[model samples]
Target: LVDHKQTALPALIEQLDSEERDHPIRKLAFTLRAIGDQRAVPVLIRAFPKTLLPASSDYGIKIEDPELKRWIAKHDLGKGRSIFSYLRAFREVVGALQQLTGQNFGEMELFGVNLANTESQRHLQREQFHQIAQHWAHWWEANQESHGVDPAYAKARVLMAGKKQGQLLDKDMRETAAE
Candidate 1:
């Protein structure tokens, strides 16, 4: 799979922008992490905003309680369904980014906060996730080019050695070895 990841990377990235709800974009993002390529960083950043909104209705439902709806509308709490979906997807996207970069950048703690536990928690966590997402976006913009990539030949050799050894090398070590 490591040997095949280079060929799959392009398609996985392209899936980030696909409008098809049936597309497993989250899975694709995680696959990019499994590929362990630094090139996936920018693509994952781009996918972050897109992931904040769930594609399926199963994630949550619209606010049906009139009192709750009015309170939310007045207080600027997001639409109930969107908030739930956004938090769920936000956590997932952040998880993928962490996996790809080996850099937490504070997202690990932010993502750990359970936004769906209660209304008050959701409101606070929503703001936190928003800020964290923006921070990640800006960080990517400033640092993407410096993220670095392993040359194809070198990556292939490492993959071959790992396969022969019947064990996968740690991703961070692989990148360090490449450097």
Candidate 2:
């Protein structure tokens, strides 16, 4: 389904947007990466912010005790984990962008930082995320029109053909060895 980027790409983007679940969104982002379409860049960028938020189910839990709620919020128990996941997801998106555009804007390093270890680290990581996202957005806006299409799409076809030829050669070799 991912290879058929003409249709599958847009559908996946819609799913990424509409689905509140992090798992589905992460799957869609990886699918888009596998598709290797330059068109997926913008969609991935838009979905980046969504990854930072805790799942809808997290909010649905009814906390009866105000003190507990305050403690949870203050310590960022669930929220910290969600942010960690978001950073990982954001890294994948940035990776896809780098692969598609052949540009490294240092986003991978920014996203890879271990922010969950300490509160100060988390603050720094959040600031870095904002900076990286802004940089990518600005870069995309400037160069979106210049990128014609996915270069990997053409390369993938070539690689597949090579693989088929290699398989045939291997089979012939096996037959010769048997004879």
RMSD of each: 16.8, 18.5
Task: Output the number of the lDDT-best candidate.
Answer: 2
Tens digit of per-residue lDDT, candidate 1, span 1-179 = 44597688777766754522323664565456556777766656545534433223324335678775664344221333333232244455666677666667676664334426566756555555545545555555456656665433112111111144334234533343344
TM-score for each predicted model, relative to the true structure: 0.48, 0.53
Best by TM-score: 2
The count of backbone overlaps in candidate 1 is: 0
Question: What TM-score would candidate 2 get against the native?
Answer: 0.53
Worst 10 residues of 1 by lDDT: 153-162
* TM-score for candidate 1: 0.48
Residue 17 displacement in candidate 1 (angstroms): 2.6
Model 2, runs deviating above 4 Å = 19-21, 50-87, 114-124, 149-179
lDDT of 2 by residue, 45-143 (tens): 555544443323222244567775664333332343322222245555665667667888766564434435566755655555555555555566567
